[model samples]
Target: MGAVLGLLVVAAGCARQVPPDLVAGAPATTQAGTPAGDIAVQVLRRYLGTPSENSFPERAFPTVYVMDHTFGDAADPSGKQAGGAPIPAATQQRIAEALAPATKVVFVADRETVLEHKESCARVKDDAILITLGPPVGDARRVTVGVNGFVACLGATWLTYVVQYQSGDGWQVTGTTGSMSIA
Candidate 1:
């Protein structure tokens, strides 16, 4: 038994352990510090490493648009995203306010303006990340919300996600409906 234990120790010492895949520099999250804001941050965290044009960067933040709502809102001028549940007004305000400090969370209200502003996206260093939040419905301990992270630049890219979060705990990405890029 002693010899076997000694052999196990030797083998363990010979094995090499790999370090966790840490972000090279500061971790970049969309966290705005509010309950919903933090939830959005978690959503962004989940999307960061996925296959996308602007994959996760070695940074602490990314500028994203904070729209009026998701699923069904005037944010999309085409009206295809209409007839969906709207995010509560108070909740939207809270998220926008919380996110303002870390990034420029704009509410352009229409797709035309979004496109218009796209011209200066590179100049201003904006990633064109539009975060349209859905109605955050939940009880005291848990909540679920819809979020769309759309990029108007690079021929456009988008991901519509539903996130469920436990109050005072971690986040859960409930859904990733679809993604598309024009070019």
Candidate 2:
């Protein structure tokens, strides 16, 4: 198992960086089949690379799992409200339901979708997830989930993660502080 995991990591390293110029005219998109957990890390790296920027690069598909930022509590805080009113607790809770350890994380297993190199890689272009944890603004929270061969990150850090196509919003489940493993 260790050898296999190591090999997967080594193989991932082979993916090679996509130069800015090539990112647009590249012959292919990032192939799927990568563990959801691995894709989760890429999401983090994306957020870390550029803070306060919202993007939904479809090419980053199969990577449906997202880790972005918002402003709200476990259940509708001031940040996640309408007309300045906090969002309903039930709605907020429902959104965070994925935080449970028992929650199942889904992935896009469609080989065709995964391999389609010419697919339109558009941004999320919506305000779907609009909540995070703790005080508004600088007060960030770190939400994580681990289950069903997947993991995620959530918090003031601007990350909203969810298993691809699976119902229910992303969760804020807890796991090792910095421990990691590959599927």
Candidate 3:
């Protein structure tokens, strides 16, 4: 476990991105077994370095990290909706499998189960990470997902990244479309 800090759940933009130099190694190259799984792992890795994934990068979260399987009440980054819906069981399994290599202790379960567990943790408001994945569209070379690091009722952020295949580059995060944060 690490220190508990503020929350930051990000809702990303369409495709506007930061320079490649800033994001460095954002390529989807992992043993997650599938493209979506690979992308999810990579995106989570970006946040795991922090306590609430964005705001508390310096604080250490002092327990096993819990991820809600379904998007639950998380806002949709697609702009076509508000909260996200449940992901297929297969998709959940794939992403969960890929999460094993993330180093930090983590587990994926239903919202109810995760919420129940969260209630029993030392820090209730600043733990759980809710996740949502946008399926592969077009040529299946591009994918996006949302990560919500809940640190408190108000402290949080939402940032969405645009990941695309660059022919010889494989699946890489070309840019971030948008981001919102609160502390």
Candidate 4:
């Protein structure tokens, strides 16, 4: 048990932290000192790294609402992800069994924003998104991509993912999702 705990600590320590750009009083600014675009990419990458083949829903769900900036809104007040029933232990074990080859994927930030759009749904006042991290990403990029999922970066983990995109404009993210943990 002590060995396992030590390993977990060492693995968690591997997380990378990159200083984020801050512009206070600016709604477009990154939150908690982390860039939204970077966060999106990091989450996407971690998900891909995991064994399970949880895929992102087809972009078929068109979201017409776009704002000039992006932000993170706690979907769960305590920041716990809800709605999806608890994953079964057996299923998790199966996922761990079918691990995919580790590969690096890159995403660039083309445009990101947060907006409330009422044109799409009426049940709520408007559609709300915590953040929108987009990169003008496509097939031409050097890094490879596969089915997406989430990775658990437990306690105090910080991630810095940089993607080299066109026009020499690179992208970066510097934090971990608080809820991304298997324990």
lDDT ranking from best candidate downward: 3, 1, 2, 4
Q: Which stretches of candidate 1 lie over 4 Å from their true place?
A: 1-41, 44-62, 72-79, 117-127, 134-147, 153-155, 160-162, 167-170, 174-183
Candidate 2 per-residue lDDT, tens place, 1-183, comes to: 000011111133432221111112222212332222222333333332332333333322223232121122212112222111222233223323433333222222121332222245312222122222211110012222221111112212222332231223321222222222221
RMSD of each: 17.5, 19.4, 10.0, 16.7
What lDDT tens digits, residue by residue, belong to model 1 across residues 1-183? 000011011133542111101111212221323344455445545554354523334433356555543443212223355433333444445445655565555654444555445446421235456554443333222333334445544433344444554456655666554343232
Kindly indicate the candidate among 3 and 4 with the higher lDDT.
3
Q: If scored against the real structure, what TM-score would every candidate get?
A: 0.46, 0.18, 0.52, 0.22
lDDT of 4 at 104: 20
Residue-by-residue lDDT tens digits, candidate 3, 44-101: 5565554443676565444334442323223233333233233334444554565554
Please write out the lDDT profile of model 4 over residues 40-63, one tens digit for every residue.
Answer: 344344433332222223311112
Cα-lDDT of candidate 3:
0.41
Residue 28 error for model 4, in Å? 12
Q: Which residues of candidate 2, in runs, are more than 4 Å off?
A: 1-32, 54-183
Residue 105, candidate 3: Cα error in Å is 6.2
lDDT of 4 at 99: 33
